[model samples]
Target: MDDGSAPAAGGYVLGSTDREMARLAALSEVYGPVTAAWLDSAGLRPGATVVDVGCGPGDVSLAAAERVGPTGTVLGLDAAPRPLELARARAAAAGLRNVSFEQADVTRWRPPAPVDAVVGRLILVHLPDPVAQVARLAGTVRPGGVVAFADVALSTRAAQPELPLLTAFNAWLLGTFTRSGRPVDMALRLTGVFRAAGLPDPVLTAAAPLERGGDAVGWSVVAGDVAGLLPVMERTGVATREEIGPETFEQRLRAQAAEHDAVLVNPLVVGAVARTPDGGG
Candidate 1:
């Protein structure tokens, strides 16, 4: 992987759009608590500096700031400008002076000084070489500092009273990532990546969201995620406009869920935390 500086011209595979921003915001609401727990387990604490890589919309960064408090500092980094702008706005609105967002490519970014921890969520799967990327992240922190990440293993998704449309859309999304040279289940390989990066064996944990019928928030979260990808899925021919049109696809999913009393189980999110050695990289 590159050194975290050379950003892709178009940035993230899921292009930044209004729908994508909404999706990210919903995801933060849904997953933020668990992610905060994971980061805390990874050794983030009051007055400790941290960096949130691929910090889209700054949810994790905001959480980190809350954890680290006023004395501590958190920097949010992403290649996309739109999300960074939103992140900045949210931070300002939230009155979080300890956190800041910057537009930077994780693959080529290098922190000015070593920090206490480096963290990212849902970003490793989009990289070509997650192991190398992890290594680079490890290098950004001080010795004995932590490197933590969370990502989805897309292949592990399942639903009860299965919604065919939802399932097929997920499959198509995974295929789109694969065709674009990204790993769809990088979380499953995170331990190996940490080891290959020369970090000690990482502590790993996983969770999945199980949303039952009539949960609008849950369904909206799912819909936002799927809708954000519809354009790319159609453009790549992984799906067709008629098959996965943004307007009706989510409605169909909701109808299916309501009709079947369905239980929607999204992909397992695997989190890994490793400590850099006493001798820095």
Candidate 2:
């Protein structure tokens, strides 16, 4: 196992903080099912081999392992060691022997063998050149193998009954990410990325609207994400602690939701799947 304290290089804006880790864990639980369905659509099979790029905490990797069953192998790769530690621990706790993790930068890491598929979630948007990265990733899989990804288009998010704080907070978040040079709406570009990678145009699917109020999970997910981005928000002058502390923001959001009977529609999460050219060796 790699040391967990080494800092990540490249242009990753979201550093590994406790708050960010919590957000990733919550997000995994919320979006794992959607990722699994996307993998199925990519034709993942019971005995196929898959590589999960930027596999934070290994949630989707574990899901893929379950889908591929005992005979298959799932490799979860990440540049950060902290998340890989968590991922390995989770896989161990789940007694999933078929799944394993490695610490390596996704941009430079090449698989020891060609895999049946390559997949990632919310990873490409952080890259400086996501289409180029996708093309590189496509080389690690066998010809005709699957390459799939999922990302969020934050601009598409909306709140019913129109909560002002929520709206402002979302704007600040988008500005923060945008200023950092990350694409806040990477999902909308998946087809182009695939085509640029020399693969056929990808088939795309969007996750159903996530409704708030049935439980606190949805609210918690949003709160954690916003909380984790507070430092960036502050640095970018997008927001400040005095204006939007995590606790205060959650309280206000919940109060407004209750008062207005509002439901929060999360940003659209889009999944795309494409296959490498069959003749490409």
Candidate 3:
């Protein structure tokens, strides 16, 4: 919203914090633990200063601090303050003082100093111009510092005979993105975005949905994702917001999860890790 320009003025994030975070949590599925592994695999060493763009609720930021250890610093940037506030609480609860959260629309803001790594998870999709955002991120990290992100891949094809509804949901989600001006193709463009910003070509990898426990342990979070995506689908007239009632949606998704004898997870999300050149990009 707000035209993706300068800082939004104390604006609310389109939905209640509880619901919004829950929505983000669902579509993101395994982002937290997966991010920890992604950073480790990238060789982000101890004491590495990290910036987590779109650090909603701050799980990735705290994880980065844990991986980097006490010597490192983590700064999380986000557009909305409610999520940042929650992130701060999460950091405190996790006893991770090395990480802090800031409220700034990163599209118009840049980190003041080079960081050891720049990361975002499920974040770039909200940007109106992700290419420009990646270019700006390239400027914030030191030469050879790692920069990486992961998001849903639209080009993926699902062969989930067992979960056609879930598969259909994925298609509708991408359509919603297209209608909202935040096309899903950006998910496939991370590597190109890195290269275009003059950074090293990114090493790409992807994840397939695996079976989850029937309880999901994070079902409430799934409700949040339904909330987040509902707007997109509604805007595109793909689904009426009423049809996507969070409770009913989660109930159905959980039912689908039960049918999970093993169906493909629709989001063939891609993750990329790249080194910033020895010289500024």
Return the TM-score for each candidate structure: 0.91, 0.91, 0.82
Clashing pairs in 1: 3-107, 3-108, 4-106, 4-107, 4-108, 4-109, 5-107, 5-108, 5-109
**Model 2, C-alpha of 175: deviation from truth (Å):** 0.6
- How do these models rank on TM-score, best leading? 2, 1, 3
Looking at model 2, report the run of 10 residues with the lowest lDDT sum: 1-10
RMSD of 1: 3.9
Model 3 residue 41 CA deviation in Å:
2.5
Which regions of candidate 1 deviate over 4 angstroms? 1-11
Alpha-carbon local distance difference test for all models:
0.79, 0.81, 0.68
Predicted candidate 3 versus true structure: per-residue lDDT over 1-281, tens digit per residue: 32233222222223535667665555455444565566666776888899998887887788788888899999998877778888898889889988988888777777667788989887777676667778788778888788898776654634345554555566676566555566556568887877787777787766645434345534444345456556545655878866666557767766776666434444566778888778543
Model 2 C-alpha lDDT per residue in residues 49-106, reported as the tens digit of each score? 9999989889889988998899999999988888899999999999999999999988
Give every collision pair in model 2: none
For residue 97, model 3's alpha carbon misses the true position, in angstroms, by 1.3
Clash count, one per candidate: 9, 0, 4
User: RMSD, each candidate, Å?
Assistant: 3.9, 3.2, 4.2
